[model samples]
Target: MSENIIDTGKLVEEQSDYLLSFAMSKLQDLELAKDLVQDTFVSAITKLDSFENRSNIRTWLTSILNRKIIDHWRKAETRYTDPVSSFFDQEGKARHWLVEKKNSTSVETVVDQITREEATMELYNCIEKLPPKWRGVIASKYLEEKVSDDICKEMEITPSNLWVIIHRAKLLLRDCLGKAEFQ
Candidate 1:
């Protein structure tokens, strides 16, 4: 194979150590870092033919390893099973059941959907009434699912400021939502 062409044998020799160290730094778990690096290599192999060598091998491998690390953390953050599953069960025992769940007819379903839509619209209207700064914070933190650090950087606010803003925002939202019930 040409030096410019990717050789599967050399990919590990050239990049595994650097990729492992990078993963270890990001993930902070030696075993997990090693596993993710292995996964990175497997992914590289699967996508081998796509390599145009536009970037260097280490960069390419590092990108794959980075994605693996992110996916690991993202998966870690999510629930193993559906969270609502804890409230409803068919097995050994449960405190109660939704007596009306099975008997709801199509008209009731349509009404429920309309009610949900109206509630959502009302909440959006309430959110819009908040100050622009609080809107950004609430949207980024709750709606966009961004971390506090990113939100702080984007909003150019300190961590404490972010906390205070979110606290006040929630309080205002509660007040607004409460008022919405009357109107």
Candidate 2:
């Protein structure tokens, strides 16, 4: 029994680098990625008895880490400040200050040629303004080029749920782009 435990421990240890890499790729924050990987290991150890052998250990650990990432994003979304109140006056009327001031003397030149990099950057900025879960769905569907079924599997959501998420994400992205003048 002790040997079996040691073997399992060794297997988990061997997977640490892969797990860290995966976390870092998804999170883009080094410290958060490290913390998430550590959390995954702790959760795996505590819940070892519950882990069925239907999937490999690496797959199970990755699933746990994915949940942690989603939880982190959900918390971030909750922390986001809504800009609606800022755009309205105390009387519930649209504030005049919300309108952009037009410059009459100097005409701004419209750039006919926008670099691909510039457009991509603008798209990313608009995507970032969306709620975190929406950003994840957009990234998985468009950036990662994953099929709907694959995205549904990865998100652990039903097909209908995946469609709903995609629909909501698209609406949010469109609103964000319009607000940011990136449309």
Candidate 3:
């Protein structure tokens, strides 16, 4: 039993980066992603007896991380917005404002002007400015690559609710990033 435990522990350590990256992709916050990864390992270790060899260890651990991400989102969404206030009421949805549509910009120009490290840092800074709720979903879904069903399950949200949150978050992120231009 002890030997089996050690093997599981080793496996977890070996796959920590993959798991962490997966969670970070979904959750976006490095600290929170790290916490979720650690928690997943702990949960897996405690439930080691359930390992029936039906699935790879990484898959099982990722499933756990997906759940954790959803839980994080649910808590964040509930905490940030009041149910009664209706700040994001469907009726009040913003109209599409493309007052001045422009052609696609060239990324090559920007890429050539900045070092990779600098560009990465700038993007990181922009991401850091995102609201917690928005950040969590982007991190988990985009960064972590967890499925929508898993995300919804973790956050205890309906698909519609998830869509609304994601939509609003993107708008906010766009506005926030726009502000960076002046600074």
Stretches of model 2 off by over 4 angstroms after superposition:
1-9, 83-183
lDDT of 3 by residue, 1-183 (tens): 564544755776667877776666556689989888889888888888787666766667767887888899899989897665553346775433333333445578655544543334335545556777667777889889989998888777889988998898778666755554311
TM-score of 2: 0.43
Task: Estimate, for each residue in 11-81, the C-alpha lDDT of model 2 and write its tens digit.
Answer: 66677876776676567799899899899988887777767576767668878988998899888876895
Give Cα-based local distance difference scores for all models: 0.75, 0.71, 0.70
Regions more than 4 Å wrong, model 1: 1-5, 80-183
Cα displacement (Å) at residue 10, model 3: 2.1
Report the lDDT tens digits of candidate 1 across residue range 1-183: 244355667777766776776665556689988989899888887777666767656657767887887888778867475556656666746536456355656787887876765456456657777999999999998889999999999999999999899899889988887776411
Candidate 3 versus the native: TM-score? 0.45
Query: What overall lDDT, based on C-alpha atoms, would model 1 receive against the true structure?
Result: 0.75
Ranking by TM-score: 3, 2, 1
Task: For candidate 2, give the lDDT of residue 94.
Answer: 78
Worst 10 residues of 3 by lDDT: 95-104
